[model samples]
Structures are given as structure tokens and as C-alpha cells.
Target chain A: MNTKAFEKLNYTLSLLSAANGDKHHGCIINSLHQVTASYPAKFTVTVNKDHETYQAIKASGSFSVTLLAADCPEGLIDCFGYRSGRVKDKFAEYAVKTDGMGNPYLMEHMVARISCKVVDSLDIGSYMLLVGEVTESEVLGDGPVLTLQEFTNRGKTTPPAATVYRTMAGNGFRCTVCGYIYEGESLPADYVCPICRAPASKFVKQD
Target chain B: MNTKAFEKLNYTLSLLSAANGDKHHGCIINSLHQVTASYPAKFTVTVNKDHETYQAIKASGSFSVTLLAADCPEGLIDCFGYRSGRVKDKFAEYAVKTDGMGNPYLMEHMVARISCKVVDSLDIGSYMLLVGEVTESEVLGDGPVLTLQEFTNRGKTTPPAATVYRTMAGNGFRCTVCGYIYEGESLPADYVCPICRAPASKFVKQD
Candidate 1:
């Protein structure tokens, strides 16, 4: 299989935490996830060690998975994406609430929410795969679910420091055309036959 | 680790998906996944061969994951959650596009789009784990990415037909709360529990 094509489909899902009533209110978590069961719904979201959501789920025992819609305002993603809950009041500006299970959620920005109980967790090196069972759910409104493409097209870019660190620390390389980080940087640079390799020139430092 | 709690969590999650998607889509999948840095930013999605997504992923070697926001509108989750793509165009009414690779994305619907190439697949009983690498990525806008609570509350009033199926199937003795099919179609009045030992009043019928 073409690895490049595979990477293209993986989504950088934004995980929302319920308003924790702390200085570090609602934070954004970028997780790599896959739905395990649609009926008796189950999903596995892998959270990296560096992300705050990982700690939240570990401490709280459960978290919510809200799917972002395409029409969602740019500021929502920006505020949650760029600002760290550690320093900024992530939920200070938004209307958020707690769910039946006590998990926090952004009431206005999401299309759906699933409140889950942590059933199992596995340690996969730098990340932890937390398997959750859906106990409750809600579908707020309807619009197109956001695609990674649309999210990238927006002028908002990851801070240079984070981008560069993610590029070098991870296997992805910076895209020359767009600043997308192709997670295949570990491959030999000389090998270039099947796909277009973003030369080192294309990369810019990520924040 | 409390296996029972995990089981409960898993059971509840399956129920939520059922309520949202319903059985019209067939069996649901359950599994955990993680994104790893080997090359191409590989991630894994576990699915059941008996489910619709599993079949689609196997047939197409690709599938799109729409992260539903906590505030998702009505009928949106049902649109993607309930219907089977094999029988219909999941994105017929919506605008969508394929990335540098062949993975299809909903144009501006998602927070980000990830086109994946199925590098390897693993089978675990009823589920198939699809592992792929992230080739292309685009961030559209930002917000508090969607969580599960938002989804559950999005369609809170919807009947729990799917939930019934989740519990019955995951545990023993056809747990009606989740809808596991019982062994004896016409259970005796004094029938005892096979899975959770719940009373007969809890069992409900999907058929």
C-alpha cells in the first residue's frame, strides 16, 4: 500500500474537555483515533504524552469526543489550538457545560458529543490508546463535518516552534506546496520514484 | 484494572452508536488505535468484519472519519452514523474532494482531512485493524474539537434501539439495556440471567 496515501486520510481530531472550572479551562487535544464499534459504539483515541487531554483523561477516567463541523468558526479552532490551557482561559469565552458523566463539552461549537467511560488503555510508546465505551450521546445541529483539507486551507498556521518540533521530533516533513507536515520524514531522502518528496527547501519552522 | 468498568464503558459506548446509527447499518465495530512514527505517520483503526465500515474499508482500502462536534446539528450524525455507504452516496448532498492521494474528504466539512494508504491490516475476532500512514493533511479552522458528550446530547431524545443491541451482544444473557440477542427466543417466565443477571424488565426488542 502507498504510505503517502494512507497518511493523507488520518485526521487530526480536536478533542474538547468539559469546562473544568480551573484557570486552564477548556483545552484542545489533537488525537489520532479510529472508531472500533459503531453500534454499542466504541472508539479508540490515542493521546500523545505532551497533550493536556491525555492527562485529563488519565485523571478524570473519562472524556468526550466532539466532531468538529466545517462551518465552525475559525476562532474556535485557533483559540483551542494555539492557546494552552495552562496559561490561557480556553473556555472563558465559549459556552460550555458538563455532560451526564461529568465530562466537559463545548455546547455551541460541536455537531455531536459522545460521553464515554474508559474501559481499557494501552501504552504505545509516546502515546496512550484510551479505549472508551459510549454511555451517552447527543447530536446538536447539522452541517458538513470538517475535513482536514478545509482546516488547512484557512490561513491560520501552527506556530513555527510547534511545527518545527513536530516535524523533527516526528516522522513528518514539511510540505513545499503547503506547509503540511508529511509524517513520512523517516524515509530515505534519495528514494524518489512513486510520490513527490517535499524537499528540505519546502519546510518552514513550525511553532 | 477494573475489567468490569471497562466492559461497562465499552457497553455504553456501543449503545450510543446504536442509538445514533441504528442497526440498519448492520453490526458495529469496536477497537483501539494509535498514530505511530515509522514512516508516513502511520495510524491504526480497528473495525469488525461484520460491520459496514469494515466492509467498506476492505473493499475500498480507504474510508473517511468525520469527527462530529459536540454541538453537531440534528440528522447530521444519523446521516453518517446510520446509513450504509454501500447502498448510498454518503456525501451526495455535500461537497467533497480527494487529496494528493486518492482518499476522499468532505471538502470543507471537517476540521482536518487525512488521506491514508492501508499499509497493513490485522484481524481480532470480529474486528479488523486497518493501519495506515498519513500522507496529506490540511487544517481548516479551529474550535473546541468535538467530543462524545456533545454527540450523545445532540440526539438525547432519540429512542435507544441501538443501545439495546450493544449490551445484549457484548455481555451475556441478552442484556436488553444494550440489546444482546438472547439464547431462548421465548424465554421461560423464570429464566435466569446469562450475562449480567439483569431482570427480564430490562430486555427490549430490536426486531
Candidate 2:
């Protein structure tokens, strides 16, 4: 198989956010799609089971999706894509608004925001495909939406500082499932990944 | 709902194809996503149940996906998208190749091709989300993948001739579910959409 061919399949990057009580979590995801165009249009999002946002959606049964704009900064991608919400408050640094369903969604550098209620879910081993029915939607801007290929191109110029530093430190154990890095001397045998909830055995020490 | 906002959320266009015995069919779809990055990568494609390609996949349990390149001609999209494979042999005019499973995939104006077997599926009203486990993949070219926005922009310059003629004739009826237009003088009570299988009741007579 030509593994590199998969990279040519461009996906639009979006911010997926959910709330459980007063706690809100957001993550960057590229696996969002509108499955149907009928009334109460249906959507599907694939989230890693270990993500805090995934847990939030499971507990709240709702989530908001914001399609990133072409001008979205690399820093926002870093904060939402690379960092784990278990240790940091992603919304603290960004302007956010609650959708009609009470789920938090980003308010800047996005082309559109859609609120959805989880109707059903399918488990695909490490990931869960959440089928959601659109509860509310808004077109926020006219800017072109960002694609994963464009994001990768931007990173080629200057990689995310946090990711670069963590990888260079050589003290990080990366979660093989979700790419979450745990920095320490050695991973605890019973440690579970805060991001994807994978066991310590699923991590490989950074080289 | 700001319905116009949905227009800004660009999606990558893909050609979904499948075969059952000696018959082959293909359709254009945008709701395709890579849900997992494991050894046998997983993907999810939402296909309208009425589509001939969807039925072919259901019968054969496998399909091929080709990501359209930026330079892909509008005529190809018009043929694979607006026309029904149930009445026309879509592969007749195009060069094609079969995968390990004997599913035909497009060979031109595409950036990549992936062959997958349906591992699971979820029903969401009029659409079925087919979870595919990659059996083989190949990068066909280095060109950028096409996006729905780009296609729309191209269409604005010149609408598909078949669609324009059908709509202008005033004798056509459009499937409310999948936008498949049926050209005829009158609707038959027992008629079911050849594209989406929606009954005559689901068709709206063009004004």
C-alpha cells in the first residue's frame, strides 16, 4: 500500500467543543461531515474516545462545531489540537459563546458554528463516531474554511513551539492513539493517558 | 438558523464506487472522513440509501474511493454526480482499474485512491454511514485535492447543461432528498427515485 497517498485526502479542520455542567472543553478535529441535508440536518464527527471533549459530549449529549477560517492562527491550532484540556483551560484564553443547547463554541477565526445533539454513536475501536442532529447553525463569516493540507503547509514554515519543545526535550512519552505527550522521567505503569485514556502501555517514549 | 453559513464549510469531494458481480456504479460524495489512523485505517462515508452505488456496496461489502484533484473537469463531476448510474454506465467513458477486491476506481484527475471493506454501518434516517477498513491505498498524483467550494465557484461560471435544461423544461421533478432531477411530462404515482429511492411523493415539480 502507498501509505503516503492518504495524505492527499484533504479534510476541513474544525473546532469541536462540548460542555459538562460548568466545565467546557474544546479540541481540533478534522473528521466532521454533514451526513444528510434533510430537516434537522444530520452530522457525524469522529472523536478519539480518550479526549476530554469526547467525554464531555458523552456526558452532555451535545456539542458545537466551528469550521476554522483560512486566516486561523497556528497558535489556536496548537492550543486546541496539541494541548490536553485535562491540564489546561482551553476556553480561558479565547472568546467563546454558548450555543442554544448550552455548548461552548469558538467565536473567532471561524467561518461557521453549528450546534448538534447526539442522536446515536458507533464505536470503532479507539474512536467513536458520534451521529448528531443539527439543533442550530449560523454562518459567521465569508472567509474560506481551512483545510488540513493548508494547516500542514503553515506548520512547515514554523512548527508549533510547544510541540517542538516537548519532542526535543526527550522526556516525553507520546500517546500513540491521540498524539498527547506526557512529560516525565518515566511513565507510571498504571498511568492512563489524560487525552485519549489509553493505558501507559500504549505510549512510546520520545526519541 | 443562518442557512447560508453552511455554504462556507468547505468539504473535499470524492468519488465513491462499488461493484456487484458484473455491474459497476459510482457516485460523487462529500461526506467522507478518516476516523482512525491504526494499522488498518478506518474511514466513514455517508451514502444515500437510494444511490445505486450504495446498494452495490451493500451487496458486495466493499468499495473504492478516489479523491478528486483540483484540476478535475466539471464534466466529470456532472457525469458522476448529476447522472444516475442505474441507467448509464458511468465507467464506459473513463479509464478505470480494479482493486484487490475487484472494485473499479477512477484513474484520472484524482490525487489518491483507497479500497476499503465495510466493517460496520449506522443508519441515520435517509442516509447510511458505512465504516470502511482500508484494504489498500495509493497516492495517484501530487495535485491538490478539490473542495466543494471550488466546485461551486466553477459551477457559478457555467451550470451543468443537463441540470439547466431539465430545470428549464418545467416538466422535471427534483428529489427533495438527493437533488436528483427526473425529466418527464407527468409523475407516476408508483414512481420511485432511481437515485435516492424516494417515492413520487418526495419529488417536487420544478416551477
Candidate 3:
């Protein structure tokens, strides 16, 4: 699975946060899915175990999803991207509020906010498939939501250290059902017994 | 689902490409996997129905995976990130070559290359899971590979319009065993037979 493959899928940059003090803290990530009809929208995300964001998600059963706007302030992107929430209280630096359902929403710029309750989780080699229900929802503004292309066109930068690691491992097949790593010959014909062996019907590529 | 949910799972990012004649198009994608024990490793990638890169992948039959260095050139990133293979030959801008198995590889700054043969494809809504057999593999450099964090940190931008669409449609889960949404809500112990009456054990998430 290569970044190019993931790139082909359209997605939005979002931040998932859990209630913290009078606000919420979380990590910025991307998604190309809509689970609205399915009360609890099942989703998959990659979190470095060492990051504060990952710790926050594990501790809190609830998280907030703020759909980033294409026109969001560069400072906002930097606040979330260039800096880590572990060392500094990022929420304190900006206007924040706990949503009606206790989730946090940045008062800065965004398109929508969805508060979710954790439903299930899948442990991949290093990441987790976090399944949650959309407990609360809010639409902020109109117009197209910010996209990966928009984020990149804005000249955003990738974290230096992470970039290197992604390059070394190379891209490969990802188990859509369990987020497992299948770095081998085209998934076994049966493709049903590698890990959970849910069956060939359950896998999706990271691309 | 939102990007916040997806970010919790830390995954790596890499480049995937398919060569045809003098033209080669690439895409930036993620991989939820670990390297294999075999020298000629194998892997798979998901190709979307809407991406220009998917066409190149189908036409070429084989693709190359390039691991971008931590401090890779932005120009290099944009060449693959912003441009569409549908309109131009992206490889024309870079030095490239076909490996022993015939997959394309960037001439400079890549950590390795893995050539795969398409084995099977599973359609899940708008995207297709491209299962490929690893026919050839090579390691080009020794360093940390890039994770999703590094790609995001480098401030890689995205196509806002396409991204938003992807958000409304990707990384969604549908139970493979039973084709249910798995929304955290418990099914009545006696609940049975709406789609398939396989019982609770059969329901799986669409990862």
C-alpha cells in the first residue's frame, strides 16, 4: 500500500478529541467514509502508539470529529500539525467549546462536527480500527470541505521523522476487516486464515 | 466517518506507480502492514474507481512502490500529489526504470521497490481492493520509513473537493461475515434474519 494509493481516495483532514477539562484534545487525521446511516459509523485510523493523541483516544471512550475547512487558518493547521498536544495545551491557545453532547469543537474554522461513542476497535500490527457511533452531529459552513489536495496545495509539511519510517516499510496490502498487514504473495487464494480469516470478502487495500 | 477516527490507527505512507511505455503515473497512499520474511515480498493496494491512478494501474498490470525519504523534495511530492495521470505523463518529470519484473521505479530517493501481479479485486462501493502477488522486491536505502504522521507533518496537501467526497464514502466497514454495520449497539440475543440469519457471531465490520 503506497501513499499514492491512499491519495487516490478523497478524504478530509479531521481531529478526533475527547472531553478534557472544559475542552477536548485529539489528533488530526484523514478519512474517506460516511457511516451516517449506520448510527455507529465504523472507521479506521493510524495512530503512533507513542503520541499523546493515541493515549487520549484510549483513555476516553468518546471523541470529536471536526471536518477541516479548505480555508482554515494556517495557524490552526500548524497548531495541530507542527506541534504536539502532549507538551502544550493546544486547546488553551484557541477558542474551544464542549459541544451539546460534551464533545469539543474548534471555534476557528471547520465544516462539520460529529461526536462519536466508541463501538469497537481492531488492532493491526501498529494501528487500530476505531469503530464509533455518531452520537451528535453539526454542520458548520457550506462550500466544499477541505480535502487532502487542498491540504497539500496549501503547502503543508509532513512530520520529518514519520516520513522516513513510511518510506522504509514500503507500501503493501492492508486487511480491511482487521487492518492486518499482508506483505506477501497476492492474499492467499482462500485469503481467510492469515489472522482472523474473516474471508477474502473482508479485505480492502490502504490504497 | 471523520478523519479524527481514522488517525487513531498509525499507518505508513508510500508511493505506488505503474509504468506504460514512456509514461508512468503514481499515487500517494497508505499501507496497514509489516514487511514479510520472504526476500521477494508481496503486498496489495486498493485502487479507487474514480482516480486517474487506478486506470494506469489497471492498464499497466504492475506498479512500483517508492519510499520517500524523510526530507524528500516538495517538488517531488507535488509532482505525484497534485497532477493527474489522466492528463499527463508524470514520469516524464523524473528519472525512472523498469525492474526485472517490469514494474516501474523512481531512479532516485526511493528506499525500495516491490513488483506485484494482480491476483484478485474486491469491490466495496467506490473503491476496489487490488490483491497482487509480490513477484520481485528490492531494498534501496537504510533508514526509517515514513508513517502517516510523517506524511501529514510534511504538510502534504490534498485535493479538497475529491477529499470531501472520499470522506462521504471511504474506510467504511460492512460486516464481511454477515454484512452488518456493527454500530456498537448490541443485537438482541435472539435477533435473527434481516439479511443473513447467521447469528451475532457472523456479523463483521467492513474495514
Candidate 4:
């Protein structure tokens, strides 16, 4: 089998977000598809079982999908795709809004957002295919949907954006492994870096 | 919900083909997605239950996916998409080949073809989501993958291709509703137009 052929297939990129109680997480995925066009439409999103967002969906029983636009900033992709949500609050820096289902969705650089309730799920070993029945959907912008191929092409021509750390006032613990900052009076004894999964021992107090 | 927004999201066009014993059928779909990137890759295809191709896959336990290329002729799409395979043999004019799993796949204007064995299926009202494990795949061409949006755009500019009926010397039946031609010594009493679901009485003998 020529696995490289799979690379040639184009897929639109989407941000799959879910919230379990107050814990919210989101990740970039390219496997969202509308399965049926009937009234109360259905869609499916393929997510790795290891993702924090997947766990949130499994617990919350719902998810919000935001189709990324062609004009989406590179920093947004890097923030969601390259880092682990477990070590950092992925939505803290963005203007996040809850859908009708109370699932979080980003408000910027998105073509559309759909709220879905889990109707069924199939476990495909490492990945879980979640079938979502559309509860509410809205067109956010008129920009073209971003494809994975176009995102890669853009990365080749544009220089990587510099990582911007949030300005901290007094007490801030930064993970040495992934530079994920935790703001508080002091780091908890059982604290772990959500992005890198590093223990408190790997964190240093920001000067 | 603004349903018009759904039309803006892009999807790559694919031909999902399956064979049950000697019965073969194929249909155009846009919901094929690679679910996992594991060693034995997994993909999901959503098919309408009303499609003859879906019944073929349900009985065969396997299917072949041909990702259409940008250069694909419009006639091919109209034949496989606009017509039903139950009344007409959609593959009669095309060069078809069986994959390792005995599922039929088209040989022209395709970027890649993948044969997959059904591992699991989920029925969602009018649609069935079939999960397949990749058994065999090959990259057929380097042409760009065709998106549904591109196909619609092409249709707007290019005039519709003329319908060319197959020439027959012996007894042949033509469907009045959909112009489907069936070449046989005599039309069966129970024969129905596969394309339009018209009854045998609706067929007229060709001169």
C-alpha cells in the first residue's frame, strides 16, 4: 500500500471542543464530515482517544466543532495542534463562547460553528468515531474553509510565529518542558504541566 | 441554523464501490475520511441506505474507494451520481478492475484507490456509517484531488455532455423515464429501470 497517497487527499481542518463541567479543551482535527443532510442533520468527528478533548466529549456527551477559515492565524493552529491541552488552558487566550449545548467554541477566524450531541460512537482502536446530531449551527464568516494541504503550503512559505508568553504579575509557575505557565499564589504539590505532563519538579517560578 | 453555511464547507469527491457475489455497484460520496493513522489504517464512509451501492457493501463486507481527480470528466460523474445502479449497470461503459478483496474499482481519472474490509458499521436512521480497515491501496496519479466545490463550479461553466446510448444489434430495452438502455434477448417480466425505478411496462423496445 502506498501510504503517501493518503497525503494527497484533501480534508478541511476543524477545531473540536468539549467541556466536562468546568474543564474545557479543544484540538485541531481534519476528519469532521456531515454524514446526513436530513432535517436535524448529522455529522461525524474522528478524534484520537488520547486527546484531552476526546475525554471531555466522552464525559460531557456533546461537542462543538468550529470550521477554520483560510485566514486563521498560524498562532491559533500552533496553540491547538502542537501543544497538549492537559498541560495548558487552550481557550484561555481566546474569546471563547459556549454554544447552545454549553460546549466551548472559538469566536475568531472561523467559517462556521456547529453544536452537536453524541448520538453514537464507534471505537476504531486508537481513534473514536463520534456521530453528532446537529443541535445548533451558525455561519460565522464568508471566508473559504481551510484545507490541510493549504495549511501545510502556508507553513512552508511563512516563518514560524514567535511564542508569546502571557505577562504575569507576581507568582507564576512555568513548565520547563513546554513553557506552559500556571498562575496562582503557589504551585500545587500535585501540579502537573498540562501541555508537557511534567511534574511540579520541572517547573520554575517566573522572575 | 443557517443551512447555507454547510454548503461552503469543502469535501473531496470519492467513488465508493462494492460487489456482492456477481452484483456490483458504485456511487459518488463526499464523506470518506481516514479515521486513524495507525499501521492498519481505518477509514469511514457514510452511505445512504436507499442506495444500491450501500446494499452491495452491506452484503460484501468490503468496498473499494477511488478518490476522483480534478481532471475527471463530467460524464463519469453524471453516470455514477445522477443515476441509480439498481436499474442500470453504472460500470458497463467504464474499465473496471477488482481489488485484492474482490471489490470493483474504476481505472480512470482517479488519484488513488483503496480497498477496505468492513470491520464495523453504525446505522444512523437513513444513513449507515461503515468503518473499513485498509487492505490495499495504490496511488494512481499525481493530479490534484477534486473537491465537491470544484465539481459544482465546473458544472456551471461547461455545457452538459450529450447522453450517448450504447448501440445494440439484438433485442434491447430502453427506459422511458431515465433513458437507460438494457441489452438483452428479452426484457424480464420483473425487470425494472435501475436508474429511474420505472417498471418493465415503461420500457420501449429499441428499433
User: Which number leads on TM-score?
Assistant: 2
Query: Residue by residue across B95-127, what tens digits does model 2's lDDT show?
Result: 888999989998799999989999999988767
For model 4 the local lDDT of residue A166 reads: 23
The most accurate candidate by DockQ is: 2
Across A57-104, the per-residue lDDT of candidate 3 in tens digits comes to 677776777777778877776666545554556677777878555656
Candidate 4 chain B has its poorest 10 consecutive residues by lDDT at B157-166
Ranking by DockQ: 2, 4, 1, 3
Give a tens-digit lDDT track for model 1, residues A18-94.
33334233444434243432344555665544455556677777777676665778788767665554455666777
- Measured with C-alpha atoms, the lDDT of residue A53 in candidate 4 is 81
Pairs with steric clashes in candidate 4: A86-A194, A87-A193, A87-A194, A87-A195, B86-B194, B87-B193, B87-B194
Residue pairs in candidate 2 whose N, alpha carbon or C atoms collide under 3 angstroms: A50-A195, A50-A196, A139-B5, B50-B196
Q: Docking category for candidate 4?
A: acceptable
Query: Could you give candidate 4's per-residue lDDT for residues A47-154 as a string of tens digits?
Result: 767667888999999999899999899899888876777678989999889987779999789999888999999988756789988788889998789887788776
**Cα displacement (Å) at residue A161, model 4:** 20
Native-to-model Cα distance after best TM-score fit, residue B198 in candidate 3, in Å = 18
Worst 10 residues of 2 chain B by lDDT: B157-166
Error of 3 at B121 (Å): 16
> By lDDT, highest first, what's the ranking?
2, 4, 3, 1
The per-residue C-alpha lDDT of model 4 at residue A163 equals 14
Q: Give the per-residue lDDT of model 3 (tens digit) for B1-207.
A: 344433333334567777655566676665322222122233446544555566767787766666665556667766665555655566776777886656567847666566677655544334444555566656666554555555665575432111111222334333222223444435455554343334555443333
Candidate 2 per-residue lDDT over residues A1-207, each given as its tens digit:
766777777767889999978999988887777776544577788787767888999999999999989998888987788777777888998877999878998878999998889999998876788898878888887788987778778663211111111223557787865676788889999999875467899887776
Q: Which rank order by TM-score, best down to worst?
A: 2, 4, 1, 3
Off by over 4 Å in 4: A155-195, A198-207, B155-195, B198-207
lDDT of 1 at B203: 50
